[model samples]
Target: MLNVFTPNRHANNVLEIKPEELKERNIKGIITDLDNTLVAWDEPDAPEEIIEWFRKMGEAGIEIVIASNNNENRVKLFSEPLDKSFIHSARKPLALAFQKARKGMGLKKEEIIVVGDQLLTDVLGGNLAGYYTVLVTPIVETDGFWTRINRKIENLIKKRLKRKGKI
Candidate 1:
């Protein structure tokens, strides 16, 4: 059960995941959480560094889709300007949205990875959907009310995973 929350890899942020490394692993598609994963949850747009990272991924022929539980308006406002594909109100930890994103990307499960900052949602959802998952440290210290609750639960789970040397 705990294995569902475990990520295949962990990084400090999205930028830490290099395009070359992904290319080597044959990862052709990326389904990522928008809030706190790519940018701070409150941030409205992608910063220059994140733009550069996206450019690099594009150069490597990697397709990316933003899969967020956030509202459609918020997701659209953040993703449209960047010309990125997106699935809003994704309801992570559920298979439907993940499946939709994967199918939209036209990539097989083995060729894609799901990246996000939360274990309860992103990691578990990705793993359950049969894709590789990458857990990134939250970019900001503060989280929204619900996310705060999830974080507390995640900390407990993390402690257990650490005790078993699974993290």
Candidate 2:
């Protein structure tokens, strides 16, 4: 059961995931979480560094889609300026959104990776959908109320995963 929450890879942030590395792994698409994973939850736009990262990914022919549980308005405001595809209010940890992302990307499971900061939502959803998952440390220490609750459960799970050397 714990395996569902385990990510195939972990990184400090999305930028740490290099385009070359993803290319080498044959990962053609990315279904990434917007809040916390890409930027602080309160941030309204992508930072300069994140913009450049997206440019690099595009230069490498990698498609990216924002799959966020956030409201449509929030997701649209953040993603539009970047010209990235997106799915808002994606109730992740459920297979529906993950399947939609895969189908939308027109890529096979192995050709894409799910990247996010949450274990319960992103990692579990990705794994359950049969795609590789990458867990990134949240960009900010602060989180919204619901996320704070999820973080508490994640901490307990992390401790157990650590005890078993699975993290």
Candidate 3:
């Protein structure tokens, strides 16, 4: 099962990749997971570090759109303050959510990158959607049990990838 998947290309959890870097990869847009990927699970606003990252990516001309499974209230609460574009009720790992986010960004699956912290949801969802995936370590350590289980599985795959020098 692990052999059937592809983890993100970047090593760091910060996912501080700039627009130029994305452009080189031919990535015109981004579909990101909001909670643990960009902020702590319940953080209300973007931190300074996050704001800078957003500004940098924006200056690079990359459009940012969030694809999260969070509810409308949670999603809007997280996004409206940052004034960023995003989709709530993403239902990730399901290609439909990723597709919706991509469409909203005015980009195609091939040209968009999905950035998130989880393997089963974010990476799998992005892979299923046929977009390039970037996995980052979670910003906080508050994930649920099910998510924790998936991480363990992901770690095993990562270890194998490392042994083969594929990560």
| Candidate ordering by TM-score (highest first) | 2, 1, 3
Off by over 4 Å in 2: none
Model 1, stretches more than 4 Å misplaced? none
On the 0 to 100 scale, the lDDT of residue 92 in model 1 is: 92
Alpha carbon lDDT of each predicted model: 0.94, 0.94, 0.79
Q: Can you write out model 1's per-residue Cα lDDT over 8-72, one digit (the tens) per residue?
A: 99998999999899889999999999999999999999999999988899999999999999999
User: Which parts of model 3 have CA positions greater than 4 angstroms off?
Assistant: 152-165
Better of 2 and 3 by TM-score: 2
Error of 2 at 149 (Å): 1.1
lDDT of 2 at 113: 92
TM-score of each: 0.98, 0.98, 0.86
Candidate 2: residue pairs that collide: none
Q: Candidate 2's residue-wise lDDT over 18-125, tens digit each?
A: 999999999999999999999999999999999999999999999999999999999999999999999999999898888888899899999999999999899999
Residue 71 in model 3: lDDT: 85
